[model samples]
Every structure is written in structure tokens, then in C-alpha cells.
Target: MPSVDPAASSMYTNQAYNTTRTTDATSMDKNGFLRMLTAQMSNQDPTSGQDPNQYFQTISMMTEVEQMTNVATSQTAQLSRQKDTNAQAMLGHQVSYITQDPTTGASSTATGTVASVQFDDTKGPSLTMADGKTLVDPDSVTSIQ
Candidate 1:
């Protein structure tokens, strides 16, 4: 009896099984796919050759995956821009945010007019008040008025 490679066998099981978790554009490039194709070709048996249709199917699946990734990235960027625009519109308007003063360390009310809104890469949004104090979370506001 001849031994079989489990990885090679799994490749033919389902198209979904081959999908890799590549969220970024760089990770889903042509070179990465070429490497995968090469690996599949190398592992295939010489006597029982892989079907040419399977090769084409794999390429089609990869193209679909890349398209889906691009769509998701575009949607995310649009959502971010919308959020920033909404935040900017809130400027000069009173907005409530749940906040605990760093100095006081007490649950007290701090209400001020909105001076400006700032968005950070990791921190999301920060609302700067007329009193020169910056509030990080929007939920920290007790009252908008």
C-alpha cells in the first residue's frame, strides 16, 4: 500500500478549506498564491496527476477571496469617514459623554460646550471641551445640554 499525504488530500476536500485568513492587501498578493500553487503541484502524485480543472478552480477561488477582501476594506474606510464627518458636525453642539476626571477620581458632573472633536487611529474619537479638557469616550457624557 502507498502512503498518502494528509495535507494534499485536504486540499481537494472543499474550496472553503483553502481560504486563508488574510485581512491585509499585502498578504493576499499574487506571490503568496503562486507559492500555494507550487506547493500543491509539488505534493501531487506523478502517476495520478491532478486534474487541470482543479488548478483553474483554485485560481478562481483565490480571485473571489481577493475581491471580497477589497470590498470589506472599502466598506470599512467609508464607515470611518462617515463617523468622522458625523463627529465633526457635532462640534459647537453640546454632547454628553461618560467621564471620570483623572485628577478628582470622583464621579462628578463636568459639562462644557464642545470645542472640537478629534479622532485617533486606535482611540477612536475624543471630544475637546471649552474648558480645555478632553473626553475620550462619548458615552461618558451625562447630559448633552
Candidate 2:
């Protein structure tokens, strides 16, 4: 029978494996925890066996961790949506953005008509300029016109 070391199994199963670097929500889920628990149960030593109390404690801890992660993810998504909504409110208003001319290499400020506003999955808001250029916050915007 295959035996699993709880500590090693837990470490491998609970490892942070987020695909998106900007947020932790990408990898945080209940399935991973459940898989870890299953592995622990399957690999437990048969002679001594696993302690029921310890197993219950581990399950409880996993539940709490999963709940906490869900809460954090929800909060982050809410905050991001709020920020995007706030940015969308600026639509139709003329905004100034710092754009560099490809040829000139000098930073020139441009005030373009706000064509539209968009939000990415990770980033909050992106403003579409009348000239067809999309600008993201901090890097693309200089001031709101």
C-alpha cells in the first residue's frame, strides 16, 4: 500500500500555484484542498493508521483556509469592480494622457476626446482615446480633461 507523509503531501497540495501574477484569486479554490485531504487519507500509514482527531483538525483548518481565501477573493473583486465603475464614470469627459511619440521620443501630453472606457479582468480601467489608442491607469493617464 502506498503511504503518504502528511506534511509533504500538504506542502505539495497547498502550494501557491496562481497563474495570474496580479491577484491570488486565480489559484485559490476548494478543490485543491479537497484533493490534498484525499491524498492524505489514501497515503496514511496502515500499521499506525491516521489519528481521527488530527484528521478532523486538518479538515477544519482546510475549511477555514478556504473560507478565508474566498472572502479575500470576493473582497478584491468587489474593490476592483468599484474602481472600474468609478473610472467608467469619467467616460465622455475629455481626459489628458501622457503619450510618447514613437518618432519624437519626447513625452508629449495629449488631450483626447474620451471615446470609451473599458476594464480588464486584472487591471481596473482602460480609457480608449479618440485617436484609437488605449491607455491604462498610472502609465497612460496624466490628468482627466
Tens-digit lDDT track of model 1 for 11-45: 21221223554467545576678898899899988
Best by TM-score: 1
Error of 2 at 22 (Å): 14
How do the residues 25-139 of candidate 2 rate in per-residue lDDT, one tens digit apiece?
6564567778877987889778987878998998898889878977887776676656666667767777777877789798877787777766544454677766776664634
In angstroms, the error of model 1 at 43 is 7.2
- How many clashing residue pairs appear in each of the predictions shown? 7, 2
Cα lDDT computed for each candidate against the true fold:
0.67, 0.66
Worst 10 residues of 2 by lDDT: 9-18
